[model samples]
Target: MLDLRDVTLVGESIGGVLALTVASALPDRVKAVVASNPYDYDRRYADGVRRGNVFANIAIGSYAIPIFGAINAALENRLFLGWVLRGGFYDKRNLPRDLLAEFDRVGRRRGFRYVERKTFAGWRSWNKARALYKNVKAPVTFVYGDHDWSKPA
Candidate 1:
């Protein structure tokens, strides 16, 4: 077995889900946990939206369309990417140049787009794992931003 020490787990977004799973399964190995914007798969509001909304259905279903890749590529173009990134922030006017540059840099990395798409698709399948959250024994901290759109859901 590998020797591990001082294991403080930190994760953001879906990675938080994975960190929670690990902490739950190996509580003794984890010293502490910090998760940012972690998703709650069992949220009633999200379930209701998925079941009741046509737009949500369309957005999810569009992944299967043949032209989806092309559309994604077009949207990720420089001009549109700025718009997309700005829309994600509550205060778009003051976004740091370095952050946008970092986003652009990361977006251009090979296979990043494919992995991002797959990660989102996998998010829908995480409901079954929600039960595991209750089993985590480590001290956990969750952080969220007030302006995040996901906060209301």
Candidate 2:
């Protein structure tokens, strides 16, 4: 069969793993792949949510964005700085500071109840990723900095 042409794919975090799986399942269909901070499907893979980050999970999942405070509590200038430094994204400079403020501003509109439920569901569903990781069959290229996987929080 003629190889599929120009199959371009991009991924970030767990989406990276999924991209790899797709390429593998149909090799002829994929010509290239790019992944940023991709998750290691292997259970043994490290750099999962570390203990300190738990506050984020809790804040977003449990506390919810009650109001303006959510911005200060979760995505404050300082908090964003910490994540950027610790996040291990190679191109951290590319991320805009104003976006953080916008995110906070917009997120506040959602209110606590909505954010809390979303967060709760988010954390609850991550387990399914473990199963997906074990079965990726595509030729995969991962782009990640050393800090991408912080010690378990």
Candidate 3:
């Protein structure tokens, strides 16, 4: 077990949901939380598909499938990953090429594709994490990017 305490948890996207969940579970250890674009709402994935561009719609929708989804995720290239990442930024320039390249490289690691697919498949369960918010005694702050595609303005 981690002998950590008085932690300030910060996370983005699905990670944001995780931070909130952890804070709720360990209110004593977690002193504060910053959740950005938390994936806690119902139909979060469907809404993203509906609002996303053609490329995003295709890429995200395919992840919902079975065998084909795994194949698609496994075959994801740098360009496709760049497109998805840039879509999250209001100013595309904010995502430097080096960071994008690093993200792509990490994504290509063995087992990463399988985990990505599993995370996408588990969205429904993660959405229920919102219920844990009421239990969080720590101060919580939420951040939303101007171009956060997951949320409607």
Model 3 TM-score, all chains together: 0.87
The full ranking of all candidates by TM-score, starting with the best, is 3, 1, 2
lDDT for position 11 in model 3: 94
Model 3 residue 117 distance off true place after TM-score fit, in angstroms: 0.5
Listed per candidate, the RMSD to the true structure in angstroms reads: 4.7, 6.9, 2.1
Q: Which candidate is the best by TM-score?
A: 3
The whole-model lDDT of each prediction reads: 0.64, 0.50, 0.80
> What lDDT score goes with residue 110 in model 2?
41
Please provide, for model 2 over 7-26, each residue's C-alpha lDDT reduced to its tens digit, 9 standing for 90 to 100: 87788866675676566566
**lDDT of each residue in 1-153, candidate 3, tens digit only:** 789999999998788999999999999999999998887764754445335466776786787788888788888888988787666666877889999889898998889987877777787887688888999999999997666776753
Across residues 69-129, which tens digit of lDDT does each residue of candidate 1 receive? 4365435655545655555466867668787888788878888766655655565555656
Q: How much is 31 displaced in model 3, in angstroms?
A: 1.2
Q: Model 2: residues >4 Å from true position, as ranges?
A: 1-4, 40-54, 61-96, 105-138, 150-153
Candidate 2 vs 3: which has more lDDT: 3
> Against the hidden true structure, what lDDT does model 2 obtain?
0.50
Which candidate leads in lDDT?
3
